[model samples]
Target: METVAQRQIHSLLAKYGESHLNHTNELIHFICIPAIVFSFLGMIWALHPLAAIAVTVVSLLYYFRLSVPFALGMLLMSGAMLWMLSVLSQDQVLKVSLAVFVVAWIGQFIGHKIEGKKPSFFDDLRFLLIGPLFVLSFLYRRFHIAY
Candidate 1:
């Protein structure tokens, strides 16, 4: 029997997939989603490292409630992003993050234009968080890993 949490994850992924059926859009998302995430985190890190850590902790807790594998993946990903941010000078973090955030969003919009569908997040804000999971789902499938 499918657990309620499993059902919820399935339903969310299926609904999110509706607008992402276009191959071009999926390809675009494959690149842009991670870029957006990293840049977004970089922005928060720019404000204060502790603020970024707090956000990551909160997000990981939510992901853990949904799926352990996903939470673990995000934990690793978040750590890597934080490490990269640490490599940059304090002044550069905000500037680089803002630039990447703007460009990635533009790419996302262009992808949606090609897709002829509005972003899933426009209908439901949770889809913003789900977007990363959606991308990770593909990796999970490719590796025969169950989430």
Candidate 2:
């Protein structure tokens, strides 16, 4: 059975159409997402585990409460990037990843244009974080996680 949290995320993804993201946008998102995560993790990892955990909790609270769409976008990008990184050389991959990040963000701007509405993240920052969890939840649903 899906947790209430998972169900809420799924409801949003269903409305938004996960596969609807542009192909190029998807590629760009993947390349940049993980880089950001690791970089942040690296910064916090040196601290005691409890302090790191605190930072994570605070960060997540910011994410879910603030910019959810951007967050979801990051999640999808992170998953795709993980797969790409496993195959590519480090230097070349970083360069490619940077390029993709720029392009994908541009694509997001374009999407908002088409929608005739500002990005949801602009309204509620949680949407940015929610975006990533949204993507992750898809995998759970696909594998038939009891949810």
Best by TM-score: 1
RMSD to true structure for each model, in Å? 0.7, 7.7
Error of 1 at 115 (Å): 0.5
TM per candidate comes to 0.98, 0.44
lDDT of model 2 at residue 74?
A: 45
TM for candidate 2 is: 0.44
**Model 1 lDDT vs. the true structure?**
0.93
CA deviation > 4 Å runs, candidate 2: 1-80, 133-147
Q: What is the per-residue lDDT of model 1 for residues 40-84, given as tens digits with 9 covering 90 to 100?
A: 999999999999989999999988888888899899988999899
- What local distance difference test score does each model get? 0.93, 0.50
Clashes of each: 0, 25
Tell me how far the alpha carbon of residue 97 in candidate 1 is from the true structure, in angstroms, after superposition: 0.2
The segments of candidate 1 whose C-alpha lies over 4 angstroms from its true place after superposition are none
lDDT of 1 at 2: 78
Q: For model 2, how does the per-residue alpha-carbon lDDT over 1-147 read when each residue is reduced to its tens digit? A: 655665665666554444335554444334433444543333343333344446556655554543454354444554454444545554454465455556656666665555455655565665555555544555556677533
Task: Compute the lDDT of residue 73 as modeled in candidate 2.
Answer: 44
